[model samples]
Target: MSNNVVPAIINLDVKGPVISRHLYGHFAEHLGRCIYGGFYVGEDSDLPNEGGIRLDVVEALRALDIPNLRWPGGCFADEYHWMDGIGPKDERPAMVNTHWGNVEENNHFGTHEFMALCELLGADPYVSGNVGSGTVREMSDWVEYLTREGDSPMVRLRKANGREEPWRVPFWGLGNEAWGCGGNMTAQQYAAEARRFGTYCRDHGDNKLYRVAAGANSFDLAWTETLMKQLGELGCAYRPTGYMQALSVHYYTVSGPWRDKGDATVFGTDDYYRTMLQAARVDELLTGHSNVMDCYDPGKNVGLVLDEWGTWWNVEPGTNPGFLYQQNTLRDALVASLHFDVFHRHADRLVMANIAQTVNVLQAMILTDPDSGALVLTPTYHVFEMNKGHQDAASLRVDLPSGVPTREVESKELATVSVSASRKDGRVLVSLSNLDAGQAADVELDLRGGAVTGVSARILTAGELQTHNTPDAPDAVAPRAHDQVTATASGLRVHLPAHSFVTVEAALA
Candidate 1:
């Protein structure tokens, strides 16, 4: 370890955009066990449930105070038919889930179940309407079915399915990935389709829909440019409209190429560092997409939604290849922390980001065992819980004056530390991550502008980078009370361990 301590500054007076609580959102797709076994174990199961929804899963996710949950898919949303999933569970027709394993989907958990799940979690619903195979009327009727009142046909159908009142679906996704799985359409094609489809998705009374068009595939700037060129302007005024309020992007952190994304728990320091490097690329991705959006909407009216993101690794051994189930480790937690740091930095343009999935899938917060219905909160979950205080908080400017710590790996320099801060209610929350695998460092936070009365903190790290929680040892990589931070004269001095993520909560005067 170097004797020279790294210095970072956080000016409490420098107020930035409100880090949308929606930025700390989650995704739950119908793929894999993310739905059927992970969240819904049937109403008659021994595991306690609320109307077929797992109580344990809901109770666990409730800790994060999750703001919004995007539903029915990455590719599944584009192919899904809402009518098939609603109505009585038994009577609902079954179909082949061609995207994620050729398993039978009984359409058990549909619109009602999802809304019920949202009610259980107190989160807003971000419904992803089908665009690839669904028609304009299909998507329009879905919005009405969930949000409309009075004697409408869609409302009558919703009532017949047992829902009396309307649901507040504030965020709606126009489609998933349009260039690939959503449908192999060109940028120009999807933009036109989105404009047409979005036109019919009415607000339906007080339920205002923020329609998000399926945006770029990673750093595909042309796709974003086309969307802005086509949908960014509404009529001759060139004004922003609710028809296309945001654009969605999907990026996953993988250690290797897509053919083989390295094992989740069987990675060395080199693999870990490479993963961190890939995770850090989100800053570049956001900035690139934001630059394009700036050309059309300089006021930042249209938001950029990183709706699908997180670590994607090969499925667990023996699991279905298409299921995308993987283990979450200390490395995964650090990746999440890194992404949140970048997300905070781009809060002006970035509005919401859902970590690939919430349960039993890629970079899941909670992993459920199919046999016993036991739930193991992954290390990534701790990052969310510890940093929940930053939600809806005013973002604070954090600057590194002593130069960012960097480590050269595989001929590339990787930033070893990431930091972000925010102030909420009279408290300031600072989140930091040390991405180094074997070196601990001392960091002095030169805090200015406000008087901090006292500070308390927590740290999440394990003995190794790959250390993860299993049902047998759930706390293997869980967070513990951190006492390494001392109140210095100007601010606070913190000692960050290798491959660790920490959050500091300070009472401001």
Candidate 2:
């Protein structure tokens, strides 16, 4: 390892908010192969499946302890009509997916299929409702169909469709991207629409909804301010009469222009640093929104939900442009690590965050091959598995030295090292990332408030930043036991390899 060392302090005595497991949530949109071929294959297919859902896919995601899954759409949410997706699969209507690839959607994986998926993964479902072209009664009926019982019309329809009892759906999105893909409505227009739509999404006997309103588009404080003013209150122990429980925001780390996101597996050092710079900006995004939210709901009654995030790279070459299929690389894993560090810092108000699309989509954890029944866990998948220990753990403050190393790209300084710590059960897990492409970081963690007894680590890295897994070489970038950690009475020392993400699990005495 190089002589350069990064010093940081982990104050175990001062604990912050419990890192919500929902912070590790995932999204499964109906875009591209994300639904049909990625997560679902026909029940009659040769591959291992349970009720038309793929078993291999569920088995892989279960390792991450997936907390919650947002479904049905990104932009597709607005155009999705719940009625078309219920009852018999063959009888269900098919619509052209105008937001995604303009391809026909069979509505095969409707509410019941989604609920079955949640059960398979042991995750809660976050259903996003339509606000663009659907009626208020339609959204109300869909909620009732999924959660209500006791002789209602929706309950009758649900029973007719074969679900004898209602399923619990905790998270509900009123609308998605109302300013753009949802309906092209202004901030005021969407806020009014959200208030009206949120009204009828009633709670069932035992299933309470965490209603999330359509919030801003990346750092648009005006939109957030509008929602806060119209729907949120200045100070209240309880939610205002018509206030939504949470607000949703969207931000993607795209290295290039939106129309032409750079290649996923073909980026140089400069491109890597630029991408990290963009990912690091998520802190600013959260701070800006939090400030606006704090002004309206001082007690933090309204939660902030970063429901859509992750890298948005260009689709792999020779693929359908609208499918959003991309390769997940070591660079993508670093972006995820950096985002988690930021999420940990803002865990108090940030309730939940879901990566863009899960399998076979942009920055997906698992990529499935359509031709052959094969699966590959991306580098990002390993990161999630390694950091799963932090879920629902008490956050510890990581105080960094003033001279922490950084790389300047295009007049912007990107921190070369990132760290976050949390305590769960009797163990403390410290996640460290060395972002430098050429230099390894010798990190000295000052462990306070508890005596360190032992330390073990595992690392995920590749020979190149663009190195990724395919069906042929699935374990090319998987995590392996690392041996570069030492623990003493006062602290722990770790050698983090360049372009790598590591987790040091320590026993605190």
Candidate 3:
């Protein structure tokens, strides 16, 4: 065991906000290989698959207990027309994915395909409707096609396309990034459009819809305020109707400008520090946005959904620039953990979040090579796997004093330790991260509100900050049993390695 330092005492209280499992949600889009090569490899491919979906990817995602998956598009959602993707695959209309890759979208993987994927993963489907290019009637018909059980033209169309029974999609995004690619409309304009589209997005028999309006982009507080104020003006009666249930926001951790987001793997200590600083800013963004939400929604009736978030680095060498594909690293994992910690602490207002693209896109969880049939789980995937225990667990309040500290790019003091605690199934799980690059931390955990009987821990770390897994070295950075945790007379003590993430599960007495 490493030498013990000044321990950071963490006192956790059992009663707190209940962490929503949807906070561990994911997002998938029609960009690059995210759909075709990453998740679905074709039924005829030589690679092992379950009904055209990659078995390896499916198993990996299922292990994380992915609660929900936002689909169709990020920017692609606004431009997409659902009718083109249904019916016979060969006869379906082909269109150019102008928002992502300028390549042809063959329409092979459409609404049915996404729902089928969701079924296999046991995840709820959150479909983003096309409001920029498609009409309100088109959006209404799409929802009806998926959820309506009674006789309807859309339902009949779905049946003709092969599905006998309708699928249940509880979450519906009114539009995506309406302030930009979604239509470049003003906040007031988008609010009116959202209301119009949401009004017609009727709930099918027994199928309730959680309508989410497209929120601000990053620190655009005015956009959030304008939308919420407009929705709030609609009065209480409209709340139960098709009004906004949540507002969606998008934020990405980019080290540099949009054109040059820096390299994913080749970076120095400064880049690492800066990237983490940006990741930590999510807390600030959420706090500021939630403050605005409280003004119009003092009751906190509507939730804030972080629908698109993750690190956006430079595209891989030789890949199409528009694809937004970047390799995942330990830095990405740290970013994910930081975000999870923030989401857990603010579970009251932040109900759901989706980490950008799940596979083969920006900060992807899994990377696949179609040529070699190589499937490797990224560091971000392990972070998700380790924290899966916190799903649906009641958030535990942890009071952690500043420990060993590191200075970020702006020379601001940052605690080397970050943590969040939750309880479920009579077990208390505490997730801790040691952010220092070269110093291990001995943390004294003060457990309150319960007696601890047993403790077991698992940690994911690497010898080098830039260490990552390739197909050839898939096990380079994976989780291993951490045996340094012990129940102290006062509470519990844990030894956290440098540049590592550890999850401690304690049996409560």
Candidate 4:
């Protein structure tokens, strides 16, 4: 298929706001490969590991520069007793993971191991505490253990466990999934619990904790508004350096209803358009949720942490359905790129967003084979690597013209591309993705009346729709560099292939 070339213009002067690093954050639940096989393979593996942390996965994530990681649980957070997983692996009591398959969860990867992994990757940690099944003292003591500077009860306990120095744990989640798996509480009930726990979650004075209240599952703006109204509003906390900072939101793109989520990669082009529609809604969700936040805090000091966002599908065959282990394809990569552009578009409001899991779980970056110890980087990882330019830079929004819209009997969707540009010191970077799958829509970039020079591009795509990586062939869907970018007097003309994802960067003359 040939892309219709159109005259485009891009302005170097008109830029948007700066990008936030939390937008590039990740998640790791204590389920499946995410803990045991995905990132932690034990220090004694023949496949090569550092103190049980997979070296290759660490290197790949470090390359993308993962900003923060949420750990220990999803639903598991609600049932978890932090003490059970801390002191010793063998002596630790055996507990069944009520959330993921009711599997026996050996407390091997505990507090120290998780903190050590964060240290290895040079990333921050967001610890999710239990509200449904734990007490306020339990939550506060956990905080004291990680953040206290001098000798205290929790600090002495930390020292007893071997880590004398305080770990810099900045983000703390009050709870996880309050409505359903967490505990079927109405907004009022959860607010009472939140106030009880959040009030006692005192600061230890060394590593400042930005406490995040357990969030509503999705785009229920009313829940957010009520959360602030019922509990002490986030920004109004007494200390300027707070124990409470932001509210979180979790949403997933599962097409064709919740039960039958079509196929992960076998969808038709129409399905691709529908999937992108749901994925692109992250932009709208942020706008709505932030509007609610602005009402309580006009300065917008309160942030929105999208702690969970990604594609969800039935588990891969032979894997436990409860585990959420699924495949990642080129189609998923396109969806991910679109989501990144959305985050950059709303950088000020969206403080952070973490995909469901980092590896071996839904929409993960890296996957590991249990028996063979083989690992593969997913298409989502490639999308993240390409967009690394926007990690910590300011976002600049350009005037984007309307493109052909994709309409269906069930869903109404638009296909126009959204792009965010940023300049750090001297170099200007623009990250863009084409959501149009049926046809390649040419974007006439207005280069602000300057002649273009020194252009380059990199793209990741595959010919077959179902193409992916496996134990034997891990590089089947890796990114390929593209040099087909062209510069013009008016602007630049870059071809975006149909049903493919690409990122372009250039030096202005």
Best model number under lDDT: 1
lDDT of 1 by residue, 1-509 (tens): 34537888988987899999999999999899999998888999999998899998999899999999999887999889999999888899998899999888999999999999999999999999999999999999999999999989999999998989998999999988999998899999999999999999998888888999999999999999999987556333557755799999999998899999999999888888889989999999999999988888888888999999999998899999989999999999999999999999999999999998999999999999888777999999999999899899999998887787899877878889888999988899999888988888778899999888778999999998889999899999988999999878888988898888989998898
lDDT at 232, model 2: 45
For model 3, how does the per-residue alpha-carbon lDDT over 211-299 read when each residue is reduced to its tens digit?
Answer: 99999999999999888877755444434234778998899999887889999999987788888888888999999999988877777
Per-model TM-score on C-alpha atoms: 0.98, 0.98, 0.96, 0.94
Q: Which clashing pairs does model 1 show?
A: none
Q: Give model 4 RMSD, 1 decimal.
A: 2.6
> What does the lDDT read for residue 242 in candidate 2?
48
Local distance difference test, each candidate: 0.91, 0.90, 0.87, 0.78
* TM-score for candidate 4: 0.94
After superposition, which runs of candidate 3 have C-alpha atoms over 4 Å from their true positions?
A: 1-13, 233-241, 401-408
Instruction: Please give the distance, in angstroms, between residue 402's alpha carbon in candidate 1 and its true position after superposition.
Output: 2.0
Per-residue lDDT of candidate 4, residues 1-509 (tens digit): 23544433356666556688889999999886688888887767786787788888889899999999998778899898889988867798989997888899888788898899899899999999999899999999998988887889999999998988898998899898888888888877887787788778876676777888777778788778877676344554422224458888999987778888877767787676677778877778888888877777766677889999899987887888878899998878877888887887778778888988899999999988887777788988988998887788766656655443344524465654555566554456666566655556455566674444566778777776567887777878887887656655567655666656767776655
Write the number of the candidate with greater lDDT, choosing between 1 and 4: 1
Runs in model 4 deviating more than 4 A are: 1-11, 231-243, 402-411, 449-453
Top-down lDDT ranking: 1, 2, 3, 4
User: Would you give me the overall lDDT of model 2?
Assistant: 0.90
Superior by TM-score: candidate 3 or candidate 4: 3
**Poorest stretch of ten by lDDT in candidate 3:** 233-242
